[model samples]
Target: MADEVQHLTRAFSGLGGLGVDEPAMVSALARWRGQPEKRSGFRKGFPGFFSSHGEMERCEEEYMLRLAAEFARLKNLVVLWAMHPWERDARLAHHVLHQHHPAAIVVEVACTRSADELLGARRAYQALYHHSLEEDVAYRARDKPYCNLLVGLVSAYRYEGPRVNEEAARAEAEALGAAVKSAAGGKLLAENGDVVRILSTRSKPHLVETLRRYKEIHGRRLEEDLSGRGREETTTLLLEAVLCLTAPAKYFSQVMEVALREGADEHEKDALTRVAVTRSEHDMDEIRAAYEEQFGAKLEDAIAARAHGHYRDALLSLVMGAHHHHQ
Candidate 1:
């Protein structure tokens, strides 16, 4: 897979965009010295070695520790990147979570941003300790977006989407292709928001058209490339969602399928929650309609009897919410 995915690139970049950059807030959130003498606030999250800041750093643990303060302090993320390095740094992830701290901000940032950077940091972190970073990340994430981001990014690679066309489609297609082509094959674009932002700011229609043309020339099918490789029904559902390009019906399929499988485990439940919460912000009515026809029931009816907990609540609310073209 690595060799076949040569010149791969990240389709989405959560780090590149700065809807709001607040550094003061980030600094405020940093409890660097808030812990007892030996235990800094960032301790406890580390294992294999000393869980102290001095221990991790003395061990040269390469990672970033972000503070909620970063988002609050400034509008831009580049500042937060300062604590995080252009290179992989897991010390950042380890310390912040401090033993019982929900999680250090480094891991959270890794969850949402570049997996290559995260993996690099994780590897660096592990090499110092002689273990797998992947295992550590899993145990720490519990069941939430942090887990989703980390797992998704690690698995992310060069994924070709179905063809698209727009006025700027040509420019956007090339730009997107170039970004991926230039990257090491290890990165993932889990956050498609950045990708869309870059492409759609131009002319969306042209972008779609450009996708169609690029695929013709390179034999790259974004839809198949993104989700088609995996055999699981969920993977197929993701492929369809990416393929939807317009309706986002794949989100619906994923939600319904979760109920059909393993009775919707906690992990599956969060994804369902997000779809319900996120889709309305992105024109989910089409998904709602698709749900009725494809699944043989309104999405609400489908989950009403089978799902439970806050996760189930979030999904139903999202399905019921008014469709607002973009979240």
Candidate 2:
């Protein structure tokens, strides 16, 4: 870690103290990675130029290490920039599945639930990773209860029309309520399939109507009732997925609220990146409005208060419509 810090500090400073820009340094590192032989002489001579002071003797080794780390870091940034939004989301989802981190999976599914978006993401996954997204999820996501729910969500091709059958919504709402009630024990219930199918296959417009009917019929919000039962991981994901589908703007606003809060950690930074990159082109404007309405703080102001460096500038620009990639 100390070595990494030293390398990052110098790499951030300039390439070998030549005062080169980050872009230039990144370019040079790309070239070096492609042609390491070209740098063999410099790498060999690095030890000879150590400072006369013993402290300076360590500089050459550190410099080389820093160069390598910076090269990898910049390369990653390049890949991130080059990726389409769907590809980025696929990679993020693939990582989440493999690592067993399911917190953001529902949000990801919500963002891509529309027919065109989900199809594009699946294609992007195949193009980038040479494998189907569903296949990967089935293989990597070992936790059975939530895995089926996630797979069902991604695989669903819901009707996109706004025309919802009110009678059906009311009836299905009751069915869902009964399904939740049937899961009386803490153990997994067969009725969970009903919950997953209802949540996954329903259209956003239809689902919203169903949730409204659910609340009216049960005299409680769907999410609250789900939580009140305290079922399992699958149920938890179901609630989050339902909320994101029904009110994405408010859901994302709460995501940003937690991300920009004081004492936030790297997880917050990552969450901010996911939402900003994915939604910028989709519902960013709605998210921004929701952010201000819910938190009483402008999205840009909140991001500016918490972020810094080029990252901060990039985020601010995305939020304020200075970039095409942002929503």
Candidate 3:
């Protein structure tokens, strides 16, 4: 048993030479300490090392399990440390929103967070990437169909209050309905600015009221009105944005469903990673509930089916562990 403990200690000591970046490696070492210390913590329960053959085998098994856990922690920390958190999120947002050729993902993230959180993410982007989030959005958005609209949506600093203006909601509901009706036949004009202004400027409470009024006045949900209108891609994208902003949990649940579906492509799996990492610390419970309700399976089962290797293990740690202590 003594020989086994010494061998394991040497093995762990040798891992220090992996020589990754300082912060990530340091974090991994810290977690290693936290998890491995439990081995030492439980030592009093057992007789001293070299007690018996059976005891030595039990000790070896316990050490191996703890080491596996520590390795998992180190692997996850390395991925998290690869970039600044905001930069990572910015890249994911860019991939989901821009590279994918639509802006609903950007709108979902921007609109879902409180104003301060959105501003903080932008600041992190500027600090790490040396450009504002809006700057990147503006540069990419220029000359696109919904360029101004996308730019406006990302740039918005909507009021984070609960206040709802009944009159404004009613008026804007009519404006939105009229804008949708005018957008038929894929004919877009600068007048789509009305839709942009209403979506980007309104508070969540106010927007919900406007959408409810839109349904009452137009005899259809705003999204239903927008859909099947023979509109262009930008108009359809804008509809997705409105739906996500209106019900973020439902939107993300749908995202997860596609990402976790059998034979899901790499992009879909990447979307799952982004959603898992970003929402793990926030509303994963709500997202998971939404997933189960929508797909009739636990999110964990879906992840286990699609993900493989350390990627699978790390994501499961985030999704299943519910311990969001990422540094």
Say which candidate scores most in TM-score: 2
Tens-place lDDT per residue, model 1, 146-242, is 3554444333322234444454565656655654453235343433444535422322234447668568655896554554345543334334423
TM-score of 2: 0.72
Least accurate stretch of 10 residues (summed lDDT) in model 1? 6-15
Which run of 10 residues does model 2 get worst, by summed lDDT? 15-24
Would you estimate the TM-scores of all the predictions?
A: 0.34, 0.72, 0.68
lDDT of 2 by residue, 137-183 (tens): 76765556667667777777789987999998999999888876767
Q: For residues 123-179, could you state the per-residue lDDT of candidate 3 as single tens digits?
A: 776776677788788787677777777777777888878889999999999988777
Order of the predicted models by lDDT, top scorer first: 2, 3, 1
Candidate 1 whole-model C-alpha lDDT, 0 to 1: 0.43
Number of clashes recorded per candidate: 52, 2, 0
Error of 3 at 195 (Å): 0.5
Q: What is the lDDT of residue 224 in candidate 1?
A: 48
- How far in Å is the alpha carbon of 219 misplaced in model 3? 2.2
What lDDT score goes with residue 325 in model 3? Answer: 38
Worst 10 residues of 3 by lDDT: 13-22
Query: What do the candidate models score in CA lDDT, each in turn?
Result: 0.43, 0.66, 0.66
Show where candidate 2 strays beyond 4 Å: 1-82, 110-112, 187-191, 229-232, 322-327
Candidate 3 clashing pairs, residues 3+ apart or interchain? none
